[model samples]
Target chain A: MAEDLVLDTAIRDWVLVPLSVVMVLIGVLRYFVSKLLRSSQTPDAKVVREGQLILRARNLRAAGGFIPVKSFRARRFYYTNEENGLLHVPKGQAQNPQAQMFSDPNMAMDMMKKNLSMIIPQSLTFAWVNFFFSGFVAAKLPFPLTPRFRSMLQNGIDLSTVDVSYVSGRSWYFLNLFGLRGLFSLILGEENAMDDTQRMMQMGGGFGVDPTKNLGAEKDGIDIIQHEWTLPKMEQRAEMVLRKLVK
Target chain B: MVGATEEARLNQLESQVDNGGGGAWEYLCLVRKLKARRSEKVLRHGIFILNSHIARSKLGGEEWTLYEQVAVAAMDCHRNDIANDCIEALSKKFPGSIRVGRLKGMLLEAKGAWPDAEKIYAQLLVDNPLDQIILKRKVAIAKAQGNLAAAVEYLNNYLETFMADHDAWRELAELYISIQMYKQAAFCYEELILSQPTVPLYHLAYADVLYTMGGLENLQAAKKYYASTINLTGGKNTRALYGICLSSVAINQLTKGRNKDEKDSADLQPLAAEALLKDYKERAPEKLPLVTAMLRNIKLVS
Candidate 1:
């Protein structure tokens, strides 16, 4: 059985240990590289205003009950007004490429910078692992794997008869690259640039997100809130605690 | 160089950090709270904390915030060198950031480079037209240049768009008051009270403005606001109590020969006087006789 074949202790030092250490060091290197490449440019003003509007709308939704009924109604009307409200997007501007809302060219440039930071090191590492550490079983799992894991855990090896748990050299490096995230975070702290998954998620996150759509959503969110003014009740409670109303 | 209370607070802060009870971030937060208005103390302690290698290692993400805080404090204290170093480091971290650009402009403003700071702020405003901080900085610049008209104009422009900005409203009110424009000051205070009616400070300020403007109708309105302030603070605001007494006396004098029954603070005066006496008796027993004499002199206690 393949299980009977004893994994050499030399492999532990030469292959397994070296691969993990190299992966971690590469991660640390990637973090610093990305940190250096990170753009200092701020978001567009329309983006900032839209973000602030959302924040203000969220605050209004939260504290609408604190202000007077008339004040709340005025704010509600100002935001949700159909013809010319802040949240209202005319049909032309909604899809217009000429609009300021869609005119953030730096956003694309920033995304390119992020991708360069993430992709360059990733591809280089993959190439290095392929060239130097290929075709050999560098390590074996202590536990067994299901048949479905055969192609995944034993990449760069051709023989199908070999058991799935027996990991090849390049597969070992791939495993170290993806699986050493917890160890990297422990060393570098959480949310570090060493995180490929975070980068992957971020790469797909921010493109084509229309601020007007978000504002419309916020308007819809604010529409359903029944703002019962709570200040009078709070004042009543204060008076009750003092045992006298000053009037 | 520390005073006794300062030493005590610093020791408490050190103990809070050394005992593992509070981390570096917590110590920074305590430093901010302790010396918020004391620019010299903030600069001293911020530099001390920032220079400490042990604390620097533990700051994580909060180090940048502490740097920004200290930079602002250093600018306030006119320590341009410190602000420069802090802003430089922040720029290295977040290159071309508008936040850092604002800091650079503030540093220029502190160094008396008004034109340079104005240019930077103008560029910043061009980028973010609705920027509240940069607009406020322009107002500050105008004030610094002794251009009161320009400062008022800037504030008025800011208030046009941001009507709910209570700070701008309050600043405009104080500016108007400084210029002896009591009517405009009164309007600002009214906006403040209308938006945040529960705030006793605005009520008190509004009453003061009205009382300063001094007419029969204004006295009545001031008396009503003073009453509201007293109600808001539950008779503890001694100034409001005195305001009530003063406005009532003025009202009585003004309506001396008129139908005083329905037009003055006639019924409310005795209640206000009694509340004032009770407050003085409970809190300042030794001052009770003077308060009683004053109330009696006003003829409300008699």
Candidate 2:
């Protein structure tokens, strides 16, 4: 059998520890940078009113059991009536041509800014790590890995003799990138942007500023929800329980 | 070291405040700012800035929510004048807002005007009978007035509409216990346990109720529930520890001529219970006398 390669302590001090620490510091830096770059836009009064109306409709559907059947029916009619339902598009907007999301210059500008913020720091960090700390085995996993993971673990290294357990500098950096979430949440609060998991999810098209689409989707949801009034049987349930109490 | 870390957190928050990013002037942010400030004077200054922001229309869609939160915080810190000012501003801005009306009721309740609070809630309910907030306030008023039966009725009505409200269920169970209705309380805990079987509190509560309404069947069930509670909490609950001892003895006495399997199960419990009590007594020496007295009473009963 071939001899197992021993890793030097110097690698731990110079490569592994520094890579982990720098990755965490970069995350903390990115958190503040993103926070500083982002602008808070207050939605207009009409948009706020629309959002509130949707929420009220949803609350009525969920907890309408508390109200009498007459009140429930009145609310259901108020929100769903064809002539003047709250979800209906106003006549002016229906007549006038509405702007497509991609056609809006402001939306394009916002998307460009978001993409720049996300891409710039990430590419810069990747370049910095590759230029300075490439081609070295920095650390080893405690557990053995199959040959399928050899290429992933040994990103900058190209030694067939090297064990699959050994991690190259870039792989170490990537590990720290994903693994520092808990530590960041411990130092910063839960909502801090140092959580890379949320950033990854957002990057995968979860975050956007398309209010028109959101409103349309919400209207569709409201239109389809079956409004079975919960109040009609509630009094009976209460009486049954009260009778049991007397027993 | 602690001071340095705290300073770093404060600096980050202050930078966010300067940039006007996130909810810097909102209630939750204000809460963090209030907790970080060393002196009440600093908190008062922060509140002043928050009020200025509200005055300048800097806050957005949820401005009423922010005002309500600030009012609540003001009430907490005994700044009743500020709370009233915020409430007055809100009531002026949204004259017929049910949320604002509810806050007015809460403020009245805070000022020891229970009748006035009740009246406001009743009025709100007449207008919007489905409002859960007003209904809850009515229940709270009933509870604060020490009318257990009235509180129970309100809670039962509340539960009919909002059956999934765990807090209301727990409150109802506690009210039943206060009125010495152990069977009804047991029913409430059973519902809670059915919904959330893994919560240690529900198991412990069920075990306690079963222990109180003692019979051979109840004691055996109580022993099993106490065991579950102990397992869930990793053997830390002293009440569950005592419950195991008492129920085991009760089971043993009640099943004097029962099957060997039942006797064997009951026999194992007291030994484990004694070991748990010993560990608990060593861990909390001040509670040792009470633990010993409880075990002695169980032994005497058996």
Best by TM-score: 1
lDDT of 2 by residue, B1-302 (tens): 13566666666766665566544554245445445533243235446555575543765645666566667767667677878988998999999988888888888888879989988888987776767678888898889889889999999987755655667789999999999999889867765664565677887898898889998767766777776676666666767766777777777788775646454344345555565556756788888777667667767322
lDDT of 2 by residue, A98-217 (tens): 254456666566666666666787789889889988898888789988888988889999888888998999988887777888888877677674556666677666344455455456
The reply for model 1, stretches above 4 Å from the true place, is A1-7, A96-105, A123-194, A244-247, B1-35, B42-134, B145-149, B152-279, B289-302
Q: List TM-scores for all candidates, in order.
A: 0.62, 0.48
Listed models, DockQ each:
0.07, 0.02
A223 Cα displacement, candidate 1 (Å): 3.6
Residue A94 Cα positional deviation in candidate 2, in Å, after optimal superposition: 37
Per-residue lDDT of model 1, residues B197-226, tens digit only: 677898889889989999987887677777
In model 2, the Cα lDDT at residue A132 comes to 81
Model 2 segments more than 4 A misplaced? A1-247, B1-63, B76-79, B257-261, B285-302
lDDT of 1: 0.77
TM-score of 1: 0.62
